[model samples]
Target: MMEPAVCGEPTEPAAPPPLLAQLRAWLAAWLTDERTARELVDYGRVGHYTLALTRWVAIIGQLFTVLFVHFSIGIALPLVPLLAAIAASALVNLVLLWVLGWRARLSERAAAGMFVFDLAQLALLLGLTGGIQNPFVVLLLVPVGIAAGLLGRTFTATVTALGLLVASLLAADPLPLPWFTGGLVFPELYRFAAWAALSTAILLIAVYTYQFAEEARHRAEALAATRLALAREQELAALGGQAAAAAHMLGSPLGTIAVVAKELVNALPADHPLREEANEILDQVHRCREILKTLGPRRAGSEVDRLVRAPLSATLRDIADEFGRAGISTEVRVDSPDGTPEPCLALPPDIRHAIANLVDNAIQFATSRVDILVSSSHERLLVAIRDDGPGFSPDILDWIGEPYLSTRHDRGGLGLGIFIANTLLARTGGKLHFGNTGRGAEVRIEWPAGALERAVEEREHDGGHD
Candidate 1:
């Protein structure tokens, strides 16, 4: 049975939920409810409002071309009822902009609504100006293209479909063009423009959304890395506090036990077997007191950098011991090829957590045995974990450590274990490699000894300032 816990062993807490999961949940919520849609956009960016301003300019430019400039261009223009309708709609849009104000950012819903209104206004312009016969009808796609870049897929898709429907409807019935005397006809070219407008909306929306979403994903990944690093630092900070508290609280009980054991030794007869047991108890209590005394001041320090650093061998042993307590068949060994003494290494929370995660993964997949081997020289330090079980499948080998990509889904693997491990180790100047030993699976971690030492020092220096 696993014991409650032993003092001095570093505990690896569960990783925070993957950010990808949070993103997926938000996307689902936004797609279902208009209220939920308002939070998905980063309206703080100036570009969000710029798109709307550009739409206004385009609408105003189109109105000027039909109402005033057509006569100069020798296009036989005449103002119709559609011109009045377009002017009134444009006026409403201008008033809406004035109410929204330039300083305030539009919510996601309002932004989407703005694009929808642009589509409606453009559709009306197309019907009046000659429907598909007007070359500028292709401009109806502008709203959907903007939606693709600034809004979620559901909203973009809605706009794209609406644009397509408007194109189709315009092909069937369009009011007479004011520029034409009797109603000019260009059958073949108009038919082509209708098909072109529909196709262009779909294609441009796909291209723009894909480009923008990919950029957003990259930013999210960078933010996630910074978050993971901060979490490791906080966990270490918490551990130091807990360790000091444990030592402080246990000091008195251990003193009383030492006193009791000494008295018992004095009371027992010299020949009695119980005397030796009492003496052993006194010795143990004395050892415990010495340990507490040493731990007291180090643990008392407020900074994580001041916590006691262990040799690599001890760190591995602590991890193995914790797993061994859980009834897993685990062995830890330090191999010195040059027969030199192993270097004492600082066990920062990030390194400890990474190693422990790999060990846990090995235990889960192993049939019987898992071995953690540490070997180092003047140049390099290496830790290799091997397990006797089926190795990673070929399909997932290249994609290992990617979030949400797991082989053991049935066993509740979220596939984030390897990713967290790999990320943390990378920060410490370590490289993680995975492969099969023909018999099972193996993961090897290596670091240049000098680079790792410097990384540890830099981390301490930075953390101390924090």
Candidate 2:
């Protein structure tokens, strides 16, 4: 039928399907958001065994609940459809197990797909049994929670949206609740309340679980980085020891060769052809000795002390000089109790590396000058590094030695230097204090006076026994 247009009357446009509109928006957002794309691409995988075990538990529980309610309690449930849904889930699980094996790890997309399936299956079962009116409707939140903990943010959000959508649909026109007397009826307001409660719980639980799991993952990664740094320092120290041993072993033979060459040069006539060759041999032998000496002390008596130990003042001065040459005016000062010689410490590679890292950090932030102060007494040794520049940010000062805690984003550093230095210092019984001085940032490292020497001695003793 056709009607003539009226001048004062207007007709409304037809609205798009809600589901199609939502799907379009979701797709557009996923395609446009770079962070979400990266997360989905790089998210870690979940093991097959873990997924299978959880699914089996859920399936068994569902079967048991349906059987008990329909048979034992005599509730007139749609047993065939309920069992069919459960069997569908079980069949999918079996197919996955058979194809992928129990040891397989599901990729990010694969895991997300599996979770979506589980959510849909659970929603379907709820739709048949009475939707939000059924007590088992609470189980719908489980998959979303697990996804939030194991999957990326976008995936979690997607799962949550699906759960909300299903809950809303169930609220609209769910099948009657199974009961001994025909069917149990719930008020419309009560059903709405249940839907609202379930939706709120899903969001809250997902957020909490995601945050907790993310924190644990970050801590684990930081610890792994720390261990790698420490291991590298240990490897360098081991290499140094090997070089010292080689130098010690080679010194005697080189000395013997030098003596023989010198004697031959003296015994041969200057005009003899052998005389120049002998002199060349002696010169080469001298060069070899000099090279070995640079590696370590040639004499066994002083090898350990000369190669492994250095005065604390000298170490600080060396670190200061290194940074001083890099455009920063670095100064070092040493103080001790009256008439006491400066303490010499076993300069293990880790300790040296830690000290160097601190000095380098100071230089990086210093506007023009850096000051290094060393003080020693009978009981303790202390080192303080200060710089004239903008001090540490007050917000992060309390969390100073934690991994990846950095304020200098412009430098493209991961902020592991301080954490590595702090960790190594702690291992050697040193305590670090961080604060802001009047002009800039200040870091103080303190250790027992003899701790360095004792640690070295223990290591050497252990090595000998091994």
Candidate 3:
């Protein structure tokens, strides 16, 4: 057996790798891509939000700053400048809130936009007070943190560099706010340098942490998808296995039915109704033969699965032809053959017989058309059959796939059509699922290219005319 996808098989195209190493490599690649980089730009929107909140914080902070200065014997006119900064900051905050809501649907772009908005808000707050000396200048950490949360490594580096540059510039040319001391000595300059270094480290660390969390989320989703596919593949193999075995065993009984029916046909007097019945018996036996014909090829695992690829149109036509002979009007919409080379190994004729019986059942209730739809998505092929007849009651869903569940007006059907389809999928690592769980009835089969090999001989052969 091949290694499962999660286990990383040699032939699996999208194999899962060791998650830690995969995360690191993916992050490196993400940061380098221009499109991913552009998504980082949306982080500025977070800045936009912080600015609004910052505006209110500064307003409240200014009120306290003024009260403190007024009550203190030495504290002075610093209140005037700080209050003005607070008011200007509030206006910017409101505008940014508008921008974020207005563009929430921008997704990644929104994240980048918020980042820039936060940065500008921080810069404005620093400028309003005595540059780096402003107490609330701790606000600068907000934008860098937002950037880290939403962007990959490269964008994060850009944010860190921009933050350091802004902080350094503010520390060097302390804004001429009223809060600044009339003169500064070495002690104040040294304190100012320390503040700048601390702010830069805070921003860089924030962004890096956020990037790690996002990468972890992506890995989790990818693992979940792989698990689902593997489960489905296992189901198909089981169905195919049961189908091949049943078809092989049924050969003897079906052959006996034919032999007995032929013997009766000759023994009956010319006008006897019993003779008609035996002829009918002969026809039913032939249907059983066709079923066996469709099930003859049964390959296991990847090497055998591809043996059953059929033209979507061809499969539909073959199905329609069988039902049409039974007085059913089936219409098929076949998408043009996909150009990919086919795998070999066609299904035995009995599998088609089982499918035909399903169409025949639908015809019993259908007023007009029976629709057969075939579609493929890469390595998977899907065939869906639907009838607009009165739908089956939910009570029948459980019984439908069982081998001998029959409720027919004609004593002919054994209700084993769906059973064989389900069985065939089990043998090939494919699946058959009932659809429209509510009112209408639909049966769908999903098979991998590898599993098809058991049912078909080659991938590129021209399918017979309908």
For model 3, residues 1-466, the per-residue Cα lDDT tens digits are 8645554445646667888667655543443344634543333333323434544665676567666755663544555555665565566555444434323223344445445655665676566556776556666676676567666666566776777777776677675544335523235666577676666566657756675655454445444444554556557655655676787799998888899999999999989989999999999889887766555443233333444545555765776775563445777764426654433234545455445656666666565667787665557776677877567656776667654455553656555455655665565566777655243567777788656654443321212111
TM-score of each: 0.58, 0.70, 0.41
True-structure lDDT of candidate 3? 0.59
Q: Where is the poorest 10-residue window by lDDT in model 2?
A: 36-45
Ranking by lDDT: 2, 1, 3
TM-score of model 3 vs. true structure: 0.41
Clashing pairs in 1: none
Model 2, position 223: C-alpha lDDT score = 88
- Candidate 1 residue 133 Cα shift, in angstroms, is 3.3
lDDT of each: 0.71, 0.80, 0.59
Candidate closer to the true structure by TM-score (higher is better), 1 or 3: 1
Which is better, 2 or 3, measured by lDDT?
2
For each candidate, C-alpha RMSD in Å? 14.4, 13.1, 23.2
**Tens digits of per-residue lDDT for model 1, 1-466:** 7556678987768677788666645543443344545533452243334855786687678778775646666565546655775676667566554444444455567667767877888787677777777777768767777677776666667777887778877777665554536566567666766667567766776567756674575456645765876687788777756765788899889989988999999899999989999999999988887776554434223343334666677888788667653445888889878775565657667778778888878888888888888888777888899988898887778878776567799999866677878888898889988888987899999988666667776665554341
Candidate 1 contains a number of clashing pairs equal to 0
Give lDDT: candidate 2, residue 159. 84
